[model samples]
Target: MSYPWQKLGLNADQQADSVLAAMTDGEKFAWLSGPMAIPLHKGEKIPAEAIGSAACYPSIPRLGIPAIQQSDASLGVSALGGVRPGDHATALPSSLALGAAFDPDLAETSGKLLGREAFCKGFNVQLAGGANLIREPRGGRNFEYISEDPLLTGIIAGHNVRGIQSQHVVSTVKHFALNAQETGRVVADSRLNEAALRESDLLAFELAIEIGQPGAVMPGYNLVNGEWASENPFLLSKVLKGDWQYPGWVMSDWGATHSATKAARAGLDVQSGSNLDECAWFDHPLREAVARGEIDGSYIDQMIHRILRSLFACGAIQHPAQRGTPLDYSWHQLMAQREAEQGIVLLKNAQQTLPLPPELSRLVVIGAHADQGVLAGGGSSAVTPQGCLQLEGVDFMGIQTPKVYHPSSPLAAIRRNSLAKKVDFVSGDSIEEALNSAQGCEAVIVFAQEWRSEALDAQGLDLDDHQNLLIEQLAAVHPKVIVVLQTGGAVTLPWLNKVSAVLEAWYPGSGGGEAIAGVLFGRINPAGRLPITFPASEQQLPHPKQVDPSTTTSLPGVKVKGDIFQIDYNVEGADVGYRWFERQQQKPLFPFGFGLSYTQFSYDDLQLCQSSDTVTASLTLTNCGDRSGSEVIQLYIRPTSGRYPSRLAAFRKVFLAPGESQRVSLRLEPRVIAQWETTKQLWHIVAGEYDIFQATDAATPGLCGTLTISAHAFGYRVA
Candidate 1:
């Protein structure tokens, strides 16, 4: 049978209008709100035909509307607690890992994998695209987001969304704006000025929507500028729907909706996970408001129209998701491994200590369950793969999120690749035992981990459970020691100088173990760059310590009486990550875009040209070493008039063989150089000369040139 959407010879809007006209008031109300698919409370049962996932909205068979099955997809098709027993899905590396690769094509490929898995598992809506800027490095969910810079985050996230929607799944670019931290997220007010908000967080979403054209947008649980993000007039009514003219529906985060009439009037199209909210505001309450004439019936029709329009536009209505579809797990695993291999950043390799010699006689692998598997970030996005190690972890919204590890043994992978006569493993539980095991070995490789998750922020950047002390002690005894970090975000490396080499492997996914082995054995060269800045210490940040709410309780999913707080984002304004460091005149432990490769690369023949309002930079990048590798070409711009700090205007990753050279030309994103003028409600580019630099990273500009731009104002909406 042909689908209703396909049967109609009209466009998405007209089809949605036809569907809305045929629906009764009860059916219209049903589409506005829905409960979480998984039962949260003690006695609640999942609705019939609903898979236990993030959320589920019932279908109207009479109208041929398919049910919306939503799943949490931060890194993959997250099977929450294996809600379906014996269920497993391919897990990709953290979003930060994808960000490090600086490959939009890879991002889109990863997105397609996520979308395919979700669709096969009967999920039509995947909460996949996380575009929030990493303003707080210690944020528990930083692993879930892309990067700190707006340009990088937007382009990467945009491609990822495009990939998901391409698979006929509705992808959402989420947490709408300024949701930078998990601490006090439910009650915290993210305060920032309009101009700064436009330049940073909003800019990321704007670009992603322009490029990806995602079918849905999810607002954060927090408040933006003194109003809940789900119902904020400026954010929803003015910016997202008005200025940008986004055609998609706005869905509230779980437990985020607080009103009925206000939310509908302000542009919230749906209430997701309605059971988590104090009440199902979009149901009876909305109906009551409509009957009382507080909200016009036309507004409800508009809401239904938007939802159905997205369903038609994204092919969710035409190609409904199905259960038990066949998937190539092996091929998917290879794709995951490929991403991990490209995203592993070699932070330090003193005296060329990496690419472990094949002739090495002895080696000891220690710590972080190297014998068992590689670590993964925790929370709702956790995917329980086959043989995954589940450790007790945080509890949120009546769900236990265990710290999960994919069954990819680094020890086994290393042994398979190494020619060493003897390879040993130590759990690193006892420092004395580890030291004894490593005593006479040729080298010691310690896998250090700092697990971060949702519902809470990390206490600090230090390695927990005395791992630092262990590394410090091991460095004291061993002459050649290597440290492989499996962390969610940046950490303070106290024993930096003590280790012979250090690898920043940020929560490598399913094939992480093999990818790590490939890099260590020189089968794959490391090219991943730092997406977020690693601060020297907490003292260098905009706020030395993260702001704590006045409430006594810190646990998420629990409401404290009179609980409310404010995060003053105005302190640093839109200057995030490396930009903050440049503004403060403080050097980071490692700068953004900083990464080392086995081979050397150099930039030369810098050239610049301007056409209309756009500035284009052309440069020659050559591999100076005798090894094949990839280099991320970073282009930065700074206004000669000192309007703003240097921003990452454009970037590209290119693979070149030994002694190979490539000439690349990149056009700067207009918003990176243009300032947001609130009074004019548009982007204003001042006519001036700007300094352009072809940089190795944010802090290291290798080649310099100048470009003159013509002054002009453009509409804020991305076309």
Candidate 2:
């Protein structure tokens, strides 16, 4: 009566026999094909039968085991029937906001929250973490991605994974290996040299594995080299299972399995989101491989064993599944507010212009998204929120204020706050009329949100005319003016000098109002930094569309805009982030890792180590300024030889008391210093000298030391 899974309660050998005996080779094959659908952000058009009643355990019932199911995870739970069942949890700020926060512990908490939500939703498996570096600004899925920096992405992803698996839910660290860009992701071959991929794209995934140790790795949709990711034996069997020792099951991306035999042979233990047809497994290539004794019943059993191990490890097989109750709009709303508050970045605060004086006699607020909370993004990660906080802030505040529209903005939240004597709503009126209406106002607030996409790159770096006009008009009437940006990503700040204050509240979730209010009133300090570089102008970037493709448009419906590698890496080369600007002696509006806090921090006690095998550095960090704050210590390594122009070596986050200082260690494996010799087309290392820097920002590599690396270690050609 006991099933093989039940027998798993016994000793290992017995359990193995129990599982093997219960299932015939065919049943084992069925279990070996254990793959589930990855629900897209856009709710699926499901067949009703599979909705309320899931297709439970075909093999598990027969052999007494249960299969696992899951979903993509840019934000939280994917909605169903236009109802968000999981909104009771917080809709945390997008990954960019979290990255901007620059606090790993904060990122850890965010991940834990997401994990709790997943646990509540009865999801056995979820794509909880993976570092997909945002190589392109126009990357369609930028909101879901962390940052262009590998260290930041890895840290954030590791936090997220640690949170999920701690709740006993299997987390998939995914689009595994190299999947930096979304364009032609399914079919395009990533023409990457090993050094490029390893240092930039693949580094994060490797670091996540080293730290997070997730139970599942979803191979990408694209072809890695010439072979599909699903069937790349070199990648899966060699790199993943052999070298890295990743014992977890390898699941193909949804609809990403290119072939059955090769995929299985390559170490793909599960085919995710496959249609319920046995043809893929039972058909020609795999069957032939089996008949020829290349792959057999044992291989099939082993594959199922890996999957079952994952389920058991995550406690999905034996634990009592407690599905959560229906979603609560109010809880979701509050979560949105907290996230919005954390997400609001105080970019500039000249003359102490913010926390808009509570003694205001009159006020004018402006932007469209101000009232319409940015619920979600477009492309693979899009999902409709149950309730948004954009419109309701006014009535809650019980304040008399004017709601002025500047196309799209967050002035609505400001309008609802206290101290406004008379409220007036304005749209497209002349500057004279707008200024006249605000005659008695002591200060003005401008709401600016940038909405950009791969389909249409930013026309220019500047804010819209409506926003420009609104700021120019409002500043004339009121010497004190503050601008709040509610956008998916970055924008130029031409009017930044003109405004007294600037807040980058990137698409704050449902609590757009309360969160903004909290930051504005100094209830909370704005610590969010710009995850991506704010371009000085559109011309500053290497435009993909401008290349010699001579193409006006792309495939219909949805399409990735440009080759991120081509634009960001090849053409732009090493001139990325503060690296490019500083190297060229050009200035950025705000440098990478630049964020002004209500408090201040300082760095000291620089130390550098140069061993034969490694280079290490350390620094003493102190919060010299008032408020309790955190600072990210950046490390850069530059080889004296031409192997690498420059690269991030190591980094650490230090939190300090006002005037309290402590020494922290920074480490670098000499391997990180290895680079490719482009002329000879081989990886190279030099025993010659290299420079090390410990600094606040990449541009300001303030403290420096020297070391040398052996050229022999890296002198090898790629096959």
Candidate 3:
């Protein structure tokens, strides 16, 4: 008696159901909870040094189902047992850097490399492809996210997912809904109205799911509206499953689960806990709930089914999983270097200070310990290089800060590439020392950095380490001062007017040193753009202060007493980043999609054509300068009928040579121009004249063309 699913040759869903039928109640419950405590090196329990098995899922040998082995792969494959000598993974630039690149092809390449590296290290599931939008600049996890704009974030993260999945490894796009900040994260409720949620945050997830087809999703630690994301029915069941029809299984962030029955019932398929914390919420409690009739057996079946479905769908079972395999470190390093080069945005280049003149004799490099290696963002995304030192202190969770410094030396690279014979260095030993070193130098390059990570929000937009004062002092003394910022996201530049040049290198990865050298010496043209708006000050932000009376902090063994933080997202609606700044008529230090190349480009021949549900726009771009470079052509839609003030519809990164011209056509998707109507609970478009702008940056209305939609033919997509 062959089952219908079996006769159909076992697709993922069907195979999952068949496996569910064979699973006993105990087996099903075991499958739903993870990081099974297997002995490490013949010990009875997991070793203290290795926090949790790199990945774990119980094996059902009878069913020929292998245990799922996954690793935290946000940046690269995380050093499973910490970054010991000769233990390193490719440290790609931060996701925000990739966002700045505004190139999905690079994002896809990154995802593929991530998958290959994780697979080589014996992992089948990759906890990668984080797509949370940059709602707050000071948000600690900003480095891990894609961009502030939903369309960009969704598209980039989607391509990343495609690259990872192509390697036959399950990729997880995560922190499921409205996890915009790290302060009061565990208990904060992201309270947004239905319309706002649908348009911005949820829309990003929806687009990513449709494009990427990821195998797993990790719901965040925060609460959506009033409910925890792990147990939020509207978010997990209705939005993710019911509406978008996401095929992936949903997992909880380590220690994110509160209740087994609630989470399981609300559509959370697995509870992946940390080895440091022995309590598995979805394990015994779920089994007991089933025994006590608190949770139906069908929910347990669904949980197991989702996990197995992803494993089968991603071909993890079909491929061989191995550990400690040798990798092409040099090739990966070179790619990481290229990613850094493509993503570093030249914010300001006054006086032609950059592409440093060949006649330069003396040059000074200051701060960020540039002689060693470039800095990296902290938290789960921090990739420990081969020779990195493991810091002694631990965060709230027993996670160590990676002090891994890759061997890419800025001083060495600059000396090797530049014409400057005398290159001086200042490690911020003292203001006086830095000042002395800067005297009479042809040019001064100051490298400033901000240390950001999980479990903590930046104090404010101000550069820490009094680096602002240092830049001010340097600019005051030196005629030509270039400030190279190594930050996670946007930072307030107090000395914006003082610096001759400003480059935003958001945690450039291992190859960052060479990338920076290439840009400085005119070897590579800077093409990266700002993924988020850089406010002049925190006063310009929608929420001037992210923490309020409702906010409270949580630590490993510390107790907190206060009302849970209520982060109101409805106040601004879908006005995130540039949208918020635009509505307020505030001036930002740097606008979104803003980047300066050594060569200039011109935008012309703006054309717009529309159908009932889609719009096609074309424009011409020409490199006006003598050098060849790349430009990101951004398309925005401003509906006269009053939806969003402006939204990014589509974007294309184009490369052009000297005196070269190219005509580019972009297809605007229906959702890009549609508004989520709260009353009707549907996506609707009002028939009106839409202004289409092909611009260099958000602040510039480069070449505007209007296209009118027929009133009688107005389209309402019931998504």
Best by TM-score: 1
Alpha-carbon TM-score of each model against the true structure: 0.97, 0.80, 0.93
Per-residue lDDT tens digits for candidate 3, residues 1-719, read: 33333445678888778777887777776657765333323444642323243457766667766667767766887753353345668889889899999999999998889888887877778889898888878998898998999999999999999888888789998899889888878878888888788888878888888888999998999988788998999889887877777777998887788887888889898887644334677878878888899988877777677777887787776564556777898999999999999999999999888889765789999988887888777766668876653443226355445545556778888888886778988897588999999888899988898877877677898897578889999999988999888887889888899889998888888788899989998999999999999999998987777663343343222223355667777767788999998899998989998999999899888989877566899988999999999999999988776556788999999999999999999998667687777766677666899888987888887899888965332223343
Error of 3 at 607 (Å): 1.1
In model 3, the worst 10-residue window by lDDT is: 551-560
lDDT tens string, model 2, 32-59? 4433332223554432212121112342
Off by over 4 Å in 2: 1-21, 24-59, 62-64, 80-89, 275-299, 325-343, 383-385, 389-439, 452-478, 510-512, 542-586, 610-615, 640-645, 669-671, 674-688, 707-719
**lDDT score of model 1?**
0.90
Candidates' C-alpha lDDT: 0.90, 0.59, 0.81
Comparing 2 and 3 by lDDT, which wins? 3
Steric clashes per prediction: 0, 14, 1
lDDT of 1 by residue, 1-719 (tens): 55445554789898888788789988888778888888777778886768888888788898788788899976998877567888889989999999999999999999999999988988888998999999999999999999999999999999999999888899998999899888888988888999999999999999999999998999999998889999999999999999999998999998899999999999999999899999999999999999999999999988888888887887888788988999999999999999999999999999999989886899999999999999998887788898888899889778988888899899999998887889999999999999999889999999999898988688888897579999999999998899999998989999999999999889999999999999987999999999999999998988767766754355333233367777778888989999999988899999999999999998889999988666898989999999999999999999888788899999999999999999999998989888898888989888999999988899998899887888988985544
- Overall local distance difference test of candidate 3: 0.81
Q: What 10-residue stretch in candidate 1 is worst by lDDT?
A: 552-561
Candidate 1 matches the true fold with a TM-score of 0.97
Cα distance off (Å), candidate 3, residue 591: 0.8
Candidate 2 at 424: error in angstroms?
A: 6.6
TM-score (C-alpha, index-matched) for candidate 3: 0.93
